[model samples]
Target: MRLLLLISRLDCLDELDALICNAFRRRGWEVIFGEINAIAADDYRCFTRGLLLPGSGEPCHPGPAALGNRETYFLDECQLVWVMSPPQDYAARDIWQMLWLASKRTAFVNSIEGMMFLDTKHALGYVLPKENRVFAYTSNDFSFLWERYRQASDQWWVAKPANAGCGQNVFLLPPNGPNVRTTLQCLTGNAVVQSLLYNGEVGAFKPEYTILQKFILEVANGEKRVVVVCGEAVAWYGREGNPDDHRSNIAQGGTPKSVELHSGEVKLAESIGLKLMEHGINFVGIDMAYPYIVELNIGYPNGLYNEMLTSGVDRSDRVAELIIASFENHCSLLR
Candidate 1:
């Protein structure tokens, strides 16, 4: 299968991309990098009767902005578009670009509409199921804002941006804590009040947890993440808080631990994957806590390969598998 992995020009040397490249090459697929800035054309026809436009960076296609604009960059191949950029910057900005692609009938991964919905924490909380068997969610209203955190039922709760990733804006809002107000003031929507699944039970989340349902938290420390490829899981480890803290997000100063998925986690992962697939949320990573899901990662996300490295799991193979599967399932339909 021929594939194009869209990414930033500077991220060309990314370790994650290297891993994916190695895996795709071993499969004998014609995998190429479509770094929007590297190519010289705004649009170039591919061997498969497909057109490749590298956005508005270095590649200069003769097409108009409507045909192709960097901010509004669009692809018509209708194949799988793997969104690997961070949720805040690329995820939000590219929302319309993706929407444009879908408006043209492109069979994008996760579908543009699904992704846009998942981009906001407020929207995620409003729509995610409270009890989907494989998934569970909870949330705290920002109505009282920080003061509501004083009524916390759990020892610790997380503060997160609805559309950001890599521990950029996550913080702990302990019951009656001092920073809860500061954190809430930094956010625009409601603050999520989730039960802390700390001390290795991070996989067990309360059924009422909704706002915290953006990504799956495994084990505990609760920041390491994983992805499922065709019912298979690739895991990543994150440290709990700091040596002095409790938030395990590596980007937040928590060290990465190796958390391999056991049978239960795998079972949970598959169940969530099937449900998401049914909803057309392909190319997704549902955050799992043992047998329940915390959130659905449908839009662009982060730390995928870094987490795999710390866990000793070779997920690049599964990435390749999904890439080929995307070529067959979505991209093929594009043609």
Candidate 2:
């Protein structure tokens, strides 16, 4: 079988992508790489520059359309296309829509429709009970934010972009904080702040709005990432934030360690994983802090390398097996 991994860029494949690509190749699957921005689509054909595996030393097969080290590929040729990049531009969105409409021919690991359902912070409302989930307010209006902030359960709130992940643009809002307005302004991009306060740095992705969630004190201990594949909890790890930082994302210098899920967490992860699988979202990483399900990572969930390093076992092998099995099962059902 053939698989196309849709990533943000070819030259910048991270550890997780490299691991997955190599794992699938070892399983006798022909693996090729495609960047979202380089894809050109039409009713007749879908074209892209198939990138060579980085650090492969030199190009072996130089096709007619080979530009430098890249090869030409047609989207219809691949049996499966695993999207690892979120659609962030017009070109990417166009490619996504084309592929989505042609999903019958090419199986998607997580369909764009599935990502739309549970990939963002907004998904918390659908997955979690009102009392169990974090109390969040999403809006671009300053008045709405002010009202929500005032009604928060605690004096502190976690302010972040609604669409971003990996702890990007996350901040702690102190009660009646001086930087409240400035932080909201920066996050929502509604009103420009003369100067950023409280270590507020501009993010890479521009967000349409922001989510102000009531801070959970229990997060001081740590957070958990439960990796679910094909509606089953396969592996999990714990992450603790760096000193003086509230963000527990490994991208933000947090530390990961091996851990087991509590009964409640196991039940929650299993139930949610099944529901997500039914919705065509097979691979996922569910983040949680005790009673609350923080985020659902359906687009590109990290931690495969970390799982191997911490547990001394390659879970990506299991991930690959499950993905192929699921894809074959889906194809069989269609047949």
Candidate 3:
């Protein structure tokens, strides 16, 4: 069997991508690397025609005419396509639409429709519980923000971009702070404002804003990152933030350590896995602080290398086996 690894760029290969590639190769499946923009509708037409050469370390660059021709095919030989990049442009969206339509014949690890549901922080309000919900609104007016703040008794608010992740452009809005209007106007424009989930217990403050979320104070100790594959929590690890830093993301200088989850936390992770499966998401990294989920990562979940290094246990082989089994099951259903 063959698998297509769709990524944004061939130049930058992260640890997860490398691990995934190695896993599939070890399983004796041919892995093809290609950019999403190179895919077209015609590529889904035939089973005999291959889009690009199999197991070619070089990137695939099928021409537009070749993509338009029904005789020309790419990815037609592959049984599964693993999307590694999130849609960031119109071209990417177009490719996603083609992939969605093609999913009828080809298996995708996580469908485009599922990714869209978890792409933005605003989407969290729908899936997460009421207490875990972080009210998100896109507007620059201070009056609107003030009205929303008045509705909540919380003393702090956070402003960030609705579409970003990894704690980018996140800021704290304090109650009764001087120059509130200026800060809100500058930060909340074309952004999202959420009630702060954390208190002054953490430490001093930093200013950044592109996406906003309720800062959970429990993350000061560290946050749990649970890797769920095919609706199972296969492995998990803790990410402890730097001193006084509220962001525990590994990208933000957070340290990784092996962790054991309690029954409640395991149940929570299972619940999230079920919800993700409903949307056809089979692999994900869920971030949580005990009772509350901080984020649901759908696009290329991280922490495999760190988890393996810290725990002396690598689940990549298991993940690879599951992916292959899923494909086999899919083929069996067709038969």
Pairs with backbone N, CA or C atoms under 3 Å apart (clashes), candidate 3: 51-74, 160-210, 160-211, 160-212, 161-210, 161-211, 169-209, 169-210, 198-215
Candidate with the larger lDDT of 2 and 3: 2
lDDT of 2 by residue, 290-311 (tens): 8888888887787677777788
Ranking by TM-score: 2, 3, 1
Candidate 1, TM-score vs. the true structure?
Answer: 0.63
Q: Going through the candidates in order, what is the number of backbone clashes in each? A: 27, 0, 9
lDDT of 2 at 90: 61
Return the top candidate by TM-score.
Answer: 2
lDDT of 1 by residue, 44-115 (tens): 322111233332223221112112222322344434444443333444455445344443544444545556
In terms of lDDT, the poorest run of 10 residues in model 2 is: 58-67
The model with the greatest lDDT is: 2
Clashes of 2: 0
Q: Report the alpha-carbon TM-score of model 2 versus the true structure.
A: 0.86
CA shift at 317, candidate 3, in angstroms? 1.0
Please give me the total number of clashing residue pairs in predicted model 3.
9
